[model samples]
Target: MSPLIDCLLIGLGATLIMDLWGLVRHPLLGMPLPSYYLVGRWLGHMPKGQFRHQAIAKASPVPGETLIGWLAHYLIGVSFAALLLLITGSKWLTSPSLTPALAVGLVTVLAPFLLMQPGMGAGIAASRLPNPGQARLHSLITHGVFGLGLYLSALGLRLFN
Candidate 1:
């Protein structure tokens, strides 16, 4: 596969794995699924020059925000995968090392910490949340899972090869 295609698959797969963790975590730990719609809503407002929200939920509803959110979620996942590829190179995609994948996943958490969470009014690193430390912990774990997914996805591709 082309490097672009590989990056896309790796990203989508890792994001899906993180999402699965979100689903299972809800039942196992009583946490709620991530509201990507809020992300969409945030993005939706950006065209109007709004970059941050005091409370994204209270922000006006945007048309197709749900679809936008889901699409953005997957796209962001793919972007992170691209970042991983940039760091590890496509050659690594062939062998699929867990360390590189996991490291990328862990580093990807910075997006939410520095950008997404704060933009959505959750505060940096979810500091605005009632339990900021717990929220941070969950975010870290989810990103780690995403990293694992990157390695797993590459392995899956190798199986087909």
Candidate 2:
């Protein structure tokens, strides 16, 4: 298969795993499922020069924000997978290992810590959250799972070849 096709499969597989984790975590732990609609709303406002919000929850809803956010979520997942391939080179995709996948996944947490969280008014690393430590821990774990997803997905793809 072409590298691009491989990457897409790997990315989609990894994102699916992460989403599955969310589904399992929500009902069991009472953790709310991530609202992609809010993400869409946030992105929708970017062209209007509204990047940051005191509280995205209070922000006006945008049309099709749900779809936009979900699309962005998957795209971001794919981009991260591509980043992993870039860092480790295409050779890694053939063999598929754990360390690099986990490293990339853990590293991705910086996006939310610095940009997403702050942009949404949660403060850096979710400092403004009711339970900042817990929230940060959740983010860390979630990203770590994403990393595992990367490895698992790669492994799955390897089986087909």
Candidate 3:
């Protein structure tokens, strides 16, 4: 398969795995599922020149915000997969490694820490959160899982060859 196709599949697969982790964590760990709707709401305001929010949930609702959020979530995943491929080269897709995947996964957390969370009014690295350390831990673990997904998805795709 072409590298582009590989990236698309890898990104989607990785994102799905992360979502599954969220599902499992909820019942087992008592963490609530992430609200992508808030992500959408934050993006929805982009056109209006609004990047940061005191509280995204309090922001005016955007039409189809939930759908927008979900799409963005997947697109972001795909983009991150592309980043991994870029860093390791397209050839890496044929023989994935855990170290690179984990590195990329952990690095992806910066987006939420520096951009997404702050845009949604959560502060840098969720410093504004009631329990910032726990939140950071959750984000770290989630991103790590995403990295694993990247490696696993590549391996799975190889099976089709």
TM-score of each: 0.97, 0.97, 0.98
* Segments in model 2 whose C-alpha atoms lie over 4 Å from true places: none
> What tens digits encode model 1's per-residue C-alpha lDDT throughout 9-99?
8889888889999999998999997668888899999999999999999999999898899999999999999988888887997799899
| Stretch of 10 with least lDDT, candidate 3 | 33-42
lDDT of 3 at 69: 98
Give one clash count per candidate, in the order shown.
0, 0, 0
Error of 3 at 121 (Å): 0.5
Best by lDDT: 3
Top candidate when judged by TM-score against the true structure: 3
Alpha-carbon lDDT, every model? 0.91, 0.92, 0.95
Q: What alpha-carbon RMSD in Å does predicted model 2 have with respect to the real structure?
A: 0.8
Ranking of models by lDDT: 3, 2, 1
Better of 2 and 3 by TM-score: 3
